[model samples]
Target: MKGRKFSPQKKDRRKAIRSIVEGIVLLTILIVIIRALLPSRGYFPVSEDRNLQTEQGFIAVSYFGVDRTGNKTLISTKRLEEHLKALTASGYVTISQQDIINYYTAGRPLPKKALFLIFEDGRRDTGIFAQKIMEKYNMKATILTYAQNLTLEDSKFLKAKDLKELEKSTFWEFGTNGYRLSYINVFDRHDNFLNQLNTYKFQLVSGYLDRNYNHYLMDYIRDASGIPMETYSQMQERIGWDYNSIEDIYKRELGKVPDMYILMHSNTGQFGSNDKVSAENFKWMQKLFQMNFNREGDSLNTSQASIYDLTRMQPQSYWYTNHLLMRIQDDTGEEVAFVTGDEDRNNSWDTLKGQPEFIKDTIALTSLPGESGLIKLKKNITDSNIEVSVELDGNKAGIQTIYVRADDELEEYLALSIENNVLYVYEKHKGGEKKTIFSLNLELHDGIKPQSLEENKLEAEIKELETELKYVSDVELTKRLNEQLKEKKARRAASVIEGAKEYIPEIGISEAGKRFLKVMLENDEISVIIDNKAVTERLKVSVTEGKGVYLEAAPSKEGYSQRNLTDDVYDGVFKSLVISRYSTEKKDDILYDNRLAGFEKVADTIQKGWDSLINWFIKYL
Candidate 1:
């Protein structure tokens, strides 16, 4: 064997080749590792861990009881007590009605574990047994009673004596389930239902007031207090009744003294039944209560001892349809001052024939009927007198007064005052010995602004027109436009194909064909045309590109079948086709380049048609 030695250049080349091969292998491994570690497209990772706290928080349980026949009842005394105990054991706190009202009205936070124990069809069992349990546990519950059911015969149902006894306990509260429990469809007519409800409220509240008055009189007599029997007689006489009027009853019973009011309703009714209490109904009631109490920001606190206590402690009232109205109170048990239906302008005064006069000192003011209607009060006085004024609207009503008195009497006599819509002196005082005495002037306005009927009609018309336009359809017109656009695009594509042939022969056949093919392959618009049935039948060529060289067969005048080639081989064949078609003229090269450029413009035109069609379909179809 002859000994041979390799040159240094050859050895260096060999080393370089080895290094390139190693680099390729390392890069491939790195890519594989990255793909494994990172998330891949269309794949999502989920954790299976179960120890995490997934629930946001617990909502207060709203509880009810049912009888054997599936009718909701409040008759079982023992069972009610057991229910309270169960609720407490579940980490729930018992609260007063006032607390619930206050929490919602003041936008305060509520406990996570709170419950509302509402008893329906106020049975005597509920007042006796449930009251004891509630008191022992310091629990608060609202009992809905059928007013008609409160008779001496049905001891199972709450009677006047039973309700009075319950009230005395401070554990259970009362509300009207309805005047009658069954048979009468009061709620079937909204107006009739409301009227009946108002009647019930007056009867219940008035009864309570009367009993308290009687008790006070009895105590006075027993103690031999100086208060006379005439005073007691006058108080009794004041207790007049007008089932049709809440305002009259309120004036007679309360005498300007603020008190708690709880309205009631039957949880189970004939039409829908208690089982009709779906989740949706519960949500609706929740929102309705919030709105009624003007509780805009937070959940209600249902953990209070009684709805009345909850309401008295808080500065707001809570009302539930077919449930109970909860009034919160203070620690001293003094009822808080509040205006109910009157605040919402849904009081008896709304339908009265004449305005209610509110008089302060020598000045008198009255609110007129009609929405946004103004009621004014004016008084004329001599010079040096001060004037007073007041305004009332659906949202708010207030009064202001002014009076001139001696400098020394300013603090004693000329005090600013406000009471509902009446404004007067804070205290009575004799004028000082100042030589001049000035007269008083006063004026009042009810702030009611009547809306224009014409404006309202026009607004309604505009809304209706807008709704019609929202649903208008133009699908057929859109389809026609899309078809027309497609045809125009096809014609434009044909023009570009015809012009490109002139430049095909300029470059060498292989190079020119390769350039043409590359332009067509890269351009979506041109590629679509080449793939078209008509174009494929008109021109055929075998093209290939390899080792940086392009080759293509010459185009024959006679049509030939289309031939497919790999990318590398096709690049060579396309170059050859371009040279054969365009010749060596510079103009031909320009034409070929320009024709290929037109493909993009054609695609843009087609895309516009697509977008217009899609948008039109979305908007008006």
Candidate 2:
């Protein structure tokens, strides 16, 4: 049987359907491309009306544990509860790292009084004692523990099972103190070769186990033939392995990764580093980790050696009431517990060493000097009115007014005043009740001191002069000059490297290339000229299209020396500049510059997406 022919109308209808389907497909593809190009919205929510100025700063407190009976390494459970109770009564709200970051970076408002609570080294009792107490008060806290300890089946440290259970809780977040928790010899313990091997072996076996791992450890052992000592690269490899291994184990066991890092022994003068090589190694590792968390390294081009300078969570140990009295300056300052009181004499266990059921309130006056009464002594001075000024230690955020009083009475000769970092307190014999007892309380301001019109103008002039002086100072100018010299060297080096790799003929080239080639190859100290422009001063340099090229100078009136490459060199098309090599040598500044340029490109590309996302959220969300 012959099939019936399709009608013209039916054929037209089918064509229309096909066309519509094609149009839909094309439209979907276009939309997807547009979405990909446009940034994703910010994951963090922000407030429309953010008042960073008025928002209270965060106070972070670090606790070891609640040691009932002061057994191993902890305060009594009673003392712990009391401290928590006092903090809660003080109208302070405990916050998370995310909360703090949100307030600082995303303009999210924080509570009027904020605090960060942390427990370190992963004691299992933390879950039993501190966790219950914190939950009772509806507080959140972060726990930091090492990966090595978690792997061990022990009651002393929090085990993998406990961590997994704790991770399920809403009030707690766990982070890494560091893996290995190994004590590094900060001094030259290498004088005894056996001690060095033992330390190395201990660290090696803690996380990774291999019979041949000892052989790898021996690679770092001392040598007599004067092979250059242990280098930072070796240390970086070890540190990297340790961190990666622990993180992997945690991810596998707990199914979660921690974002916070706390320094275990920051005050101990060494953080798992032995000598110079290890120190640098630790610096690099820490920087890498910090950059990973904060994502600031890419933007700031932070030096690895300056990892300590990065904004990180600082530990403040509060063992007593005086320890809680931190003098806050403003929105940006450290929470430091003054180590004034003798913990040996004032700790909860000091009085109740044997009694586990003693009333916590009996030892409530552990840190307040006023409760015990002032110790009587000869004025410690001959003057009737002994006026002395004490300086605030390490509080640099803003101007603060400190109020000092003895008991509840204001002494006739005793007065408190603060001038910047200086704290002035005076005591007189003509006082109503002469007492040496003192307590410090702070009144915080916006940190901006209002100035009169004349004062403002004078100050502005002084700042301007200072700025000018700074630019022209010997050190500043030398830095600028050195940068210019380095740029020249780098550009010269890149040209040499590229020419060498490509085997670009040495005979025929532009006059500029000839000059560059001569200085690089012959080691002649001839000033380089590029594109008929005499580079007597600073000039921008880059490699593009597989060839070295020059860009315009920065928008500055200051003339260039050899060529001072400013930050702008990596902006726009300049970021596309190709860099082939970098080195660990001091003389390889050129290589360093090249690597930095390359890194800038990669970081910028990654950050672009984030920026787009933030902008999208700001606009749409």
In angstroms, the error of model 1 at 423 is 77
Clashes of each: 70, 7
Candidate 2 local Cα displacement, residue 34, angstroms: 58
lDDT accuracy of residue 575 in candidate 1 = 11
lDDT of 2 by residue, 1-621 (tens): 999997999999999999999888657655644553332331222233443333345556666665433432476555576667766666656767676555544666566556667787788766656665676567888787877777776667887777766756666778776665543321111121112223334433222121221122113433444343556576557656766776687787677656666543332234432455346435545543431221110111112223232223321222333324322211234332322232322322222110111121111112121111121111122211111111222112112221121222222323332222222333333234433322222211223333333333333333333333333558877676666545543432222223322211111000010111000101111122222333322211111111111111111122121111111110000111111122123222221011123665678677666555544543353
Q: What is the alpha-carbon lDDT for the whole of candidate 2? A: 0.39
Which numbered prediction scores highest in TM-score against the true structure?
A: 2
User: Each prediction's TM-score against the native?
Assistant: 0.24, 0.39
What TM-score does structure 2 among the candidates reach? 0.39
Residue lDDT tens for model 1, 1-621: 977886999999999999999888557545643442232222111122322221211122222332211222222333344445544554445544454465545544444444445555565534444444555556666665544455436655666666655655565555443334211111110111211112333333221121112111111121123234334334233221111122332234323211222222211221112222222223333332221111111223343322222211111111111001111111122222222212222221122211222111111122211111112111111221221221211101222222222122132322222222222333223443222121111112223332233333333333323333333368875565556545543442123224332211111111111001111211111111111211211121111111111111111112111111001001001111111111112212221111123665688578667545533432343
Prediction RMSDs, each to the true structure: 38.7, 36.3
